[model samples]
Target chain A: MWERNPVIFLLLATAVIMVGTIVTMVLPFAYVNTERDAIASVVPYSALELAGRDVYIKEGCNNCHTQTVRPLVAEVIRYGDYSKSGEFVHDRPHLWGSRRTGPDLARIGGNYPDQWHYDHMREPAAMAPGTNMPPYDFLDNRDVDPELTRRKMEVLGFPYSDEEIQALAGKTDMDAMVAYLQKLGSDIPWREQQRVTLVGELVNPFAGDPAAIVEGRELYERNCAACHGSGLSGGFAADLTALNYPEEIFFRIIHDGIQPLRMPGFATLGNERLWKIVSYMDSEQVAP
Target chain B: MERPAYNYDIVKHFVHWSILWGAVSVLVGVVISFQLVMPQLNFGEYLSYGRLRPVHTNAGIFGFAVGGFFALFYYMVQRLCRVPIWSNGLARFQLWLFNIVIVLSAVTLLLGFSQSKEYHEMEWPIDILITVLWVAFTINILMTIFKRREAQMYISLWFMMAALIGVAVLFVVNGLSVPVTLFKSYSAFAGTNDANVQWWYGHNAVAMVLTVPPLAVFYYFLPKSTGVPIYSHRLGIVAFWSLIFMYLWTGAHHLLWTPIPDWVQTLAMAFSIMLIAPSWGSVINGYLSMNGQWHQMRDNYLVKFFILAITFYGLQTLQGPLQAVRSFSGFIHYTEWVPGHVHMGTMGWITLLICGAFYYLAPRLYGRELYSIPLANLHFWLVLMGQLIYSVSMWIAGVVQASMWHSLNDDGSLTYTFMESVLAMYPYWWIRGLGGVVYLLGIGVFVYNIAMTARGAQASPGAAAQA
Candidate 1:
């Protein structure tokens, strides 16, 4: 029967493929509940963030950095918690890259300040030495098409207001990309608690030392200036002078990085250096 | 009986273009391999690693492998079916259209207009062109097969048919998307579903394009070169059916440790392990066919390629399933080991087989003896040594990476930062780059040999006609 009839053979062969595909690929979709209640915290990208996502796709970032954190202890520790199916419910054409030429970016949201991303994109070697990532400085000058981004969101059936689209009009592709990156894996309940935790009462050891303050100022210029503005005014990160938190809280936050936020631990920089950075911050601000 | 006047024009055209594209892909691959170690090599916006990596893959898979398939399929179908191509005009059109689609793919990807899906990077318009191109070729082949004078369909014909249907279904299904702009589209499937579907298409693209098509070519050309029929036709038929059944289920093996459901991962792993039986069925068939012809391995250059290719296929199939296991995947999932595994199949098995096929076809098409057997032997050794050096260095690097990543201090703090791991890979990366240079040199030798062969044919018309 298989020997003579080509049509029968073709039909049977095709049927086998369809059955395999249907069972694996197609059937899984039917089981996934698209309703909001099926998963918690699966929100669509905001108008600005949606635009940033467009920039992300346009730049082909997924070719290097993967966006899916696997369910392994090593991955969970290296990245944050293992990714949940619910976390990516809003992701269309998920960027779970098969190759990892660089680290996974699944939980990169709020992991660094916007300025750090900007600097890193412009010149990655400045931040992480020996990185093979190419500079995307061209994105800095290219303005995003807000209207087109909004239209695309509408086509995808995401709810966005006209006001939101108008707000994104002046934004650059770099701004959108940064915005999109800052939104990734940022909605977990535990991450919110980590951000809200305030360090308890403790004294700064280096507060009165003039020499330490001078060193601290230099360290802040090299490291903190990218996220905090050059003058310590607000930019991608929070304004340092505006926050009147105790010196100890500042020390703890700097020592043990803030989870789900862009604040990586400066523990590698040594406790003495961190104290100096805190001292620099304390001296720069006038008492409220 | 006079053999029906077979059309050699399309075959010759595809061979010429496929070799050109093959060289381009290998050169680009070498560049990207170096870019991993030397960030300075990333020239500017357009030539960045992110943009050029897809170009390397698309050109290698579509331009080189698929392009070679077109030449081989057209050549084999005519002889097997005992008829001329169903339409000379359609074949001619497809030849040009194939080149156009590939060029547009490279340009659009470099411009950063991509779907960002691996292996399916081209945006909506290019997707349409590819679909159209596949349909045209499919109709031509199927129609020719239906009108054949041959009484029975050969195993190679079955593989050709499977590839036609398999690729079409996989391509279209994975390509279902909502067009957001002229060069942008969003996949219809969201999140986990999207991942499952993409890899389903992704891994099978390897299966259909790289695995099945090459198997078809191997089954056809191996016997023709060795002057022996395949040891068991029944085994070939069984292997074909089993491969078609098992390959589709194994795509999620790529998604093993990810957020995909555990059952799906297990299913994929099981099927992947099961895949080895059929993969070896063909391997065994090839080996048995060469039982008494082992001496030819020393004499015939084509035999060296065929034997080594099947041997790599055997090793690839075994290693592939082993990697799919959850415990093993956890260790090497994102490491350099995976690339090492992949290159053995691609560089060792598929490329060698395709090159061997070209050597066989060149003389027949051009009506001339090869320019140099010594050059072909040199080409084989260079590529073999190059591929080994490439895969081996990567394997050692991957092990070091995986162990370092999983290491912890007594207090459970992570032992190595990600950058430390990156730093460690520099030596391996340099070695891998050197391996690429050697392989590229091999390709250079190959092209020069083929060009000289064709030129030699053109130089003397009487000698060519007599042969």
Candidate 2:
């Protein structure tokens, strides 16, 4: 049966592939609620966020940055809570990349404000030192095509109203990209509440101590220079030298860490070390 | 009775184009390697690493590897069946369509129309083109096989058939997507399901396109080059069946620690380890076939490539299963180590074997001798050195990076920031770029030798007689 007729061989080959597809591809869909309305976290992307997704796909960001955080402890600590299947139910052809030349961006939304991503994308080296990433300044110049984006989304059954689509007009690619990034993992429960609670009454412990300033400089170099740049100007991450944050908010940010932004909480460094690092950053800001 | 004149013309066409595409793929790969260390090499919008990286992968897998397979498959099927391709016109049409599809893929990817699925990046329209093209090629090969003069199929025929059917199934299933625009589309599968399906297609694409086809070439050409048949046909059949059975179950191993069910991951891990047996089965067959004629390793340049190629295949199979283990994957899943493992298979095993096949075919196809055996030897050593440098440096860099990322202070604070790990990789990236340059230089020598051979250069008297 196997040797004589080629038909039987082809049938066997087809049968194996069918079995594989049924188990790996079809079976998973049955378990997960893929419809946007069925899952709370799986909201349809806003018009601006949708446009940014197009930019993300166009730029092939997923090549270096993955969107799925595995269930491993290190991965969870490094990239927020592990990714839930329902959170990505609306994502078409999910952005779970195979490699991580850069860090995972699963929970990148709201990690940094708009300006941080802007400065980082324009000149990665300006924010983080020793980065291999290239600048995407072209995004600033390119305008987003809301109509095309909307039409594309409509075809894919994304719930976008005409008014919402129209509001996306005149936005640059960078604007849309930032909007999209700021929306990632935004629906995770307690993310906003945690940030609010941490910042409510916190204050920098070593706001202007001279000795702590010196110590803070050392801490920044050892702990922050790789992503934030040695000059605190920027490379792979945001420019700490440029941003002006109130003492209380800064302390809260440092202690709690911005989970979505891939910044680990250094609370284990203790209040003293954390204060010193904050003081050091403040000293750099004040210096000529 | 005169056998129908086998279509060597179509074979010639595919061979020429395949060599051209292979060179393009290698050149782009070297550029991207350099871009990792020196970001200034990125030419702004169109050529950034983000955009061009996909081009490099698509060109390497679809253009170079698949193109070479078409050329060789056409050459082998005709001779094995003792008949011309079932449809001469259909073969001619496929030749042009193949070039058009590849060129379009490169252009569209650079213009930023990708689905973002690795290995299946081309958007909906191109996916449709690919489906049509694959079906045509499948029909041409299978129809020819069915009308063969030979009743019993050889092992190469088995592999060729598997590739024809295997690729068709994998491509069409994974290519399922909802078209959002002429240029854009979304995967029909959502989230975890999409990840699972993509890797299943991705890993098996490597198996069918890179693994089985090359093994088919090795089985056919190794014996022909050395004037010896493979050691055991029965052993070859066992290995083939076991490999096909085990390979599909192993794709989930790529998702080891992910949210995919633990049982699935463990199943993948077990199957991946079992796979080494069948993989080494072919490797052992290649080694034993060389029992009496081991001296060919020194005398014949082709033997050097085949033996080395199979050796790398053996090492790659072993390392792949080891990486699938849960603990090992925890250390290396997203590091430079994965690429290091991958390049050995592409550069060492597949590329070397294909180059050997081309070298064996060039003289007969062009009716002339290779321009220089010394040059071929130089090419061999250069690529071997280059591949070792590339894989070794990355492996070391990966281990260091993984250790640093997992390091913790006595107080349970992280010892190093992410930036420190990125900083440490600079020197290794520079070494990798250097390795790429050496490999590119080797490709230059290879292209030159083939070009010279095709231009009707004089063959040495002894070499001319062999052809």
Candidate 3:
């Protein structure tokens, strides 16, 4: 019965699948916790904000934006604190999207004002000028009633007060969309004191010294002149010494390496050496 | 008594048209690759990357891969079944419509009439056309199987059956939408339901289109290439059934670390891991079939393509399941590694096998020796080198990017900006473009050889059957 029959193979495959469900799928759910410290900070949305979240989902906004930042070192440094798993405990459908058509929105709240989000939504190019994002002008002054928006959110299982919906009646769809955008990445303290301390720990004694310039110039001539040019004009493929960039950008090149760009971040470059390189690049400018 | 000779004429016609569409697909792909490096290749307006991407993907998948399968299936089925196609008139109509649909897809996608769904991007009207065309093709094939002279259906038939049924289900379900205008439609499934359906369609498209159809072609062509039967038909049956059972559960793997239920994500990851077993079953079967015929790899061009293609299939299956694990997927899910994985399957396994199948069929269909065996051999090497370079460079880039993006300072802030990570991809992108150029050159050689062969060739034993 087991040797040649097709039915037996189907049965065997089904059994294996059921077993797989038990081992891999159902088993993991028993012990997984959704609670964490950040959950204390993540508050429930207002009635209007909930309506906007529904709009976000309807438009497939989650397809382009992510709400979670993995606890990787680079992510922590650039995007503020790492996102905790517990931060998403209250979320019914998580928004950790697979693609990055736009930037992550985990902590977008207060990063830009509500007006910025409103203008950005209406036409990203008008707001940012260089963005590739499509316009969501359909949200502006749409015929959708505030009551209808509230009902939709209610139907989607968002707990909202009827009085709250009645009070905010006739609000535009853009208002809700902006409200949702305003809630992104809102938890961290405004200032990052710890980051400054870490950067300070890695500093060199001669970081602001005049003599470091001569030493860095000599090093640049020996190691960097072939690619960057003698005049530091960035003569070849990627001209780092190009006039358009700020000196801080050069400081970054000395600190972190660019890999796929073929310009490696100088992780080994001393803080003093980096400052020197910055000095050489800054000297080319007439201070005008 | 009039004994009708076997019909190779329809087979010949399918071969020619399929190759034409294949040429369009690869040429567009090459042009788009250059556009990435030199943005001047962006013809502006409708010819932008957002629109042209669907053109390259849809053409290669439906036009080249599936179209080639149609020709191969039609030719192989009749011989195996010991009967002619259930309806030859229907097949001829299908061939013409097939070409028309491909042309329409190219035109409309370039013109920017898309649903913005990956692989299912064609507008609602074109989606309906595809459904009808597929149904007609499926009916013809299935009915032929129903009346087969041979009692035991071969392993190839199993894969063909999966593809026909699987595609119909995936396409119709994912394609359910309300058309707001002639060129636009909103999905019937909103929010989470829409996401579930899209990935369901997306990952299963891989199963039906990429996995099963190729399995059908591979099962039929591998034995034919080596002049030997497979290692075990029973093993093939086990692998096929297991693949069907496991693949549908796996679409959610792409939705990992998302808002989807943790249980659902875990289910997909587990199923994805289990998928390795069935995939490797066919790979092992291919290797075992070549047990005594290992020497053929040295002398036979067809065997070289077949063996290497299977080897790549094995590697891809192993790599894919590993990537599905939560830890590994976390690292590489949105990274450059993902593209490397996809291209290895497409360029290395699928395209390599398709090219081999055509080479094996060309002489048999035209009744002539190859226009040039040496050129075919050269084409093989170029594609192999190109696919390897493309995949490896992307893999390295993905690892670096993933690690950098994950890096954090002691104070728990991000170390690299998004711009910095993006800047890192330029060199790898250049290398990838160079690799694409090499692959494109090989495809050019393939097209030239086919055109020359068709221009002047004596008909073979089965040549009378085609007309």
Residue A88's lDDT in candidate 2 = 74
lDDT of 1 by residue, B1-467 (tens): 88898998899899999999999999999999998888888877789888998999999999999999999999999999999999999999999899999999999999999898899999999999999999999999999999999989999999999999999999999999999888888998888889999999999998999999999999999999999999999899899999999999988999987777777889999999999999999999999999889999998999999999999999999999999888898888878998899889989999999999999998898898889999999999999988999999999999999987787655344567687788899999999999999999999999999999999888999877897
Query: After superposing candidate 3, which stretches have Cα over 4 Å from the reference?
Result: A1-288, B1-5, B458-467
True contacts kept of each: 0.67, 0.57, 0.09
DockQ computed for model 3 against the true two-chain complex using alpha carbons: 0.11
Q: What is the TM-score of each candidate against the true structure?
A: 0.91, 0.91, 0.72
lDDT of 1 by residue, A231-281 (tens): 578667778886777788788888677755658775535456778999988
- Model 2: which docking level applies? medium
For candidate 2 chain A, which ten residues in a row score worst on lDDT? A191-200
lDDT of 2 by residue, B1-467 (tens): 78778888788788888889888988999999988888899998789998898888888888888989998999899988898999989888888888899999999999999999899989989888888888889999999999998887788988898888888878888899988678988888877777788888888998889999999999999999999999998889889988877788778888887766666688888989899999999999999999899999999999999999999999999999999999999888888998999999999998999899999988877767777899999999999999999999999999988887777655455566666788899999899888888988998999998988877635445555565
Residues B161-204 of candidate 3 have per-residue lDDT tens digits of 76777788789877877664566555555434445567777887
Worst 10 residues of 2 chain B by lDDT: B456-465
List the per-model TM-score of the A chain.
Answer: 0.73, 0.75, 0.61
For model 2, state the Cα shift of residue B442 in Å. Answer: 0.7
Please state the CAPRI-style docking class of candidate 3.
incorrect
Q: Candidate 1, residue B269: CA error in Å? A: 0.9
Best by lDDT: 1
Pairs that clash in candidate 2: A124-A235, A126-A234, A127-A234, A127-A235, A128-A234, A128-A235, A128-A236, A129-A229
DockQ values, each candidate: 0.50, 0.50, 0.11
In model 3, what lDDT does residue A171 have? 77
